[model samples]
Target: MDVKNKVVIVTGAGSGIGKAIAIHFAKHGAKVVVSDINLESAQKVVDEIVTNFGEALPIKANVAVFKEVENLVQHTVANFGKLDVIVNNAGIGPHLLRTHESTLRDWDRVISVNQTGVFYCMKVALQQFLEQGYGNIVNIASLAGLKASPNNISYSASKFAVVGMTKSAAMEYATKNIRINAVCPGYTESALLTQLINAKPEMDAILKSVIPMKRYGKAEEIADAVVWLASENTKFITGQTITLDGGTSL
Candidate 1:
């Protein structure tokens, strides 16, 4: 639970919140497995961690593919001997579009990656956790999971499913020493949000005004919350979604 020298796996760790989480955990003396769909990106992070004297292994894995997820777990345990924590952070947000204009293709794509992908990772990790009799999982959901957002129907739906799945799994393993939880980030300062802000400069002011904090969250800030949830600091915490939205949901 201390996570010091614990074997941890973080998906989508090539960039953004996932990357920060991986780095943070490594900095705290945890052996991290950095996984992503993009091998190059994951390798970059892994290299940085190594340079900083942290332990890490970069693996190319697309969480949407079940076999790849299984491989991810298999390889981690093979290398580290056991897995203590897993962060299901790989996800895609659908392009902003009204439901009337959104296609079934769009729905499938979002659901497959955001929803089904989480399931695959959880299922595989859960098996290992059960065998070890202890494990922790932190899923990166979204504010959309807690509140409906127009023009993001697909994304919202998928995240809502993640929240539900987290709770259900937590209950199933509560007595088994497996803790499952989610982190819902709202309008964080990440590559995705930066692209949107750059495209519509005016929307920047609007985004800031909506949040009570009058600013976007830093990736490291969300990383802090995640690390805490994954650490022994919150052993009693489980089946909960910690929202890091700068008080936007409030």
Candidate 2:
């Protein structure tokens, strides 16, 4: 788990799981780039890191846009002198509708941010890694990617693409010193889950009942896995999807 002095970027790092990942990497002595669509939120995380005597920089970038994603990577390298890791953590949750009930707009929006955004970040980061000779990438997928998600077609489709992309890219670059991996978290405690639970309180019990642990995963727990995937400890592991579902997937 040695990430000391490594230049890392975590997208959607303004809040929730992405925020936790950024903070965790900073705490581990990594020079973190807190990239989020919300500049204010990203800066707040950076300020908190600075207060904690950790190095972090805030950058406003919408991952849905390739240009913005490219700029995000460029800025990180310019500021930190090298890029070591990029966490593709920015994503939108499902619309909670069946395939037929889901709107085309929802599908497009989710695909743009959740699927295409990961591609953009990975593409740019891969280019940088080729130049530098080594790098790591950790994508934040979801349990839906590994198994069917009822009433969540678009989200599942997007995350599945992330899993596929992670493996494909990992194999393609394995010999080039670039490692790619993904984390699939299920019902993690975050603003996204809170919002879902608030919208349908009954789902709270239903979700907990299905899980063997009978509890939701914490954001920090997901962050821990993400950081480990990006650390030197897992240098030999790549193209794998690490599921953190508390046995829910079972």
Candidate 3:
């Protein structure tokens, strides 16, 4: 869609790829809703967008919580007066641990936020879309969804579910004017990646080893893909997963 005047919601917009996508949408004239668990971080993004003269709203929400997700949509509609697009980008990758070594807490937290969170957001967003008869959704998945990268079972499983859910929703709404798609990224250079790198410097070499590009992806690169998916350019496209893996998944 011509994002020139669209209302878009970007969860996890406080940092990394989420922030980049929100900024791109705003730069292109969309009224963006920057929702994140960090109020200060979300506000900072809103402040930057406003500085650029783009309209945006900063909201603090934990997408994993049903109530918070509900309030998020309610508030967005109230402020923007309508809904057009939603980027289910909030996710958590589990730290390195063998399958037998992973804890229940680790599994629950990752699955709840990364998997169930997408469902909650999509559920509420679809309700609005059905009422309005139009909508777009982009779920950020990962290369792990397509292949076993070892470790990160919870994250990988959640992402795999996202891809399936995107396809199922797209088919279910094929004629209903609601589009759902996913973006599967390889290891991207962002705050999350940085943290992982700092925790284990050897991981840097290991991550690059799997990538044919021999380099990490930038947040802006992934953002570009998301904006295109959200735009009219992909109007006929749904139930698809676009991989920006720099050949890592290949």
Candidate achieving the largest lDDT: 2
RMSD of each: 1.1, 0.7, 1.0
Sorting all predicted structures by lDDT, with the top scorer first, yields 2, 1, 3
The TM-score of predicted model 1 comes to 0.97
lDDT of 1 by residue, 60-128 (tens): 999999999999999999999999999999988777788999989999999999999999999999999
Candidate 2 global lDDT: 0.95
Report how far residue 73 has shifted in candidate 1, in Å: 0.4
* TM-score, cand. 2 vs. native: 0.99
Clashes of 1: 0
Cα distance off (Å), candidate 2, residue 214: 0.9
Residue 137, candidate 2: alpha-carbon lDDT:
94
Q: Which stretches of candidate 2 lie over 4 Å from their true place?
A: none
Model 1: clashing residue pairs? none
Clash pairs for candidate 2: none
Better of 1 and 2 by lDDT: 2
**What would the TM-score be for candidate 3 when compared with the true structure?**
0.98
TM of each candidate vs. truth: 0.97, 0.99, 0.98
User: Candidate 2 on 60-130: residue-level lDDT in tens?
Assistant: 99999999999999999899899999999999876788899999999999999999999999999999999
Residue by residue across 1-250, what tens digits does model 3's lDDT show?
3688999999999999999999999998999999999999999999999999999999999989999999999999999889999999998778768788989999999999999999999999999999999999999998888889676788788889999999999999989999999999889988768877898899999989988989999999999999999998888889999999899877
